[model samples]
Target: MTDSALAPIDALLRTHIAEYPGFPTPGVLFRDITPLLRDAAALRTVIQHWKTLIPEGIEYIVGTEARGFVLGAPLAYEIGAGFIPVRKAGKLPGNPAGLSYDLEYGSARIEIPENSLPAGARTLVVDDLLATGGTAAATLELVRRFDVEVLGATFLIELAGLAGRDQLPGVPLTAVWTIQD
Candidate 1:
């Protein structure tokens, strides 16, 4: 949970990041991570960093849609836990539980396959970034619907100034690198 253990992966993130001002809207600085996703070393570093931060008794890694599946799948593999996809509404093939919430720029809904995780299963939520806590909070709500215990939540990088953590009150949240903006 400390920055000390996160140092090894900092260089990789910095190398692959790009920032754009006023993206998707005015007065918004968009941080793109496609560069990191395209690099083997950077991806490996992300999985490695997450492997060490997983909370004890975590039986599953619940990844938020899109980017979360990108890194969370691999991290779950390395950590010997199962990966549960919390995808966008209508993306999954079966009956799924859904949650709607606001985004940094818009509103959206997310879902998880019904009965994907057993009742009381301990889980850790992972994602590439933490900008607004809405997605993560919604994911946690989905987890609760399945009756899973959230061991903790982890992110590769956190946009710290957004107060994303405040929305997910009482959860043990950790990010490898936090950018205050």
Candidate 2:
């Protein structure tokens, strides 16, 4: 789709994003995107927007496990890039590279297959949201173990006030929306 076609998509996201206060904890407001995902047109717009940012030589898209899968799979197909999952520890079979980090509520580890991509392969990381940057940062570290060149990290939304970008120094980031908390 053309750039002009994406305007409606941006508008749809602003209209549909639902906000919940004290979600999963007190003093925390969550920008719920399920409403936007439920709208077919909005979802298509987001995928198309993401497709435009994928670098030309990207061989793989490393998507964080779970929610990231929702965006990454369709995006992989859209751009003809291979999809690799950065899963929680023990969720993957065979040997994988693991990295540990803390989340808003707890600490955890994420992993990816050691040989998922060839050495020096270019990759793009995708996820639904960027909050504290822990998950994305850990995933980036895991990808580096394979000696791959990370193209960038992309997200549907970024919580600007959380300072997630600070954790991701030197890496490019792209997001459709930015919300200051």
Give per-residue CA lDDT, model 2, range 85-148, as digits (tens). 8898899788888988898878999988877988899899999889999898998888888888
> Model 1: per-residue lDDT, tens digit, 1-181?
4567566677677878788899989988887889988988887877787677768667999998788988899988997899999988889887788988898889999988887999989899998888878888888887888877888899988999998999889999888778987
How much is the lDDT of residue 68 in candidate 2?
Answer: 91
Q: lDDT for every model?
A: 0.85, 0.85
Q: After superposing candidate 1 on the true structure, give the runs of residues whose Cα lies further than 4 Å from its correct spot.
A: 1-5
Give the clash total for candidate 2. 0
lDDT of 2: 0.85
For candidate 1, the per-residue lDDT at 180 reads 85
The runs of at least 3 residues in candidate 2 whose Cα sits more than 4 Å from the true structure, single-residue gaps closed, are 1-7
Q: How far in Å is the alpha carbon of 33 misplaced in model 1? A: 1.7
Residue 49, model 2: lDDT of 77
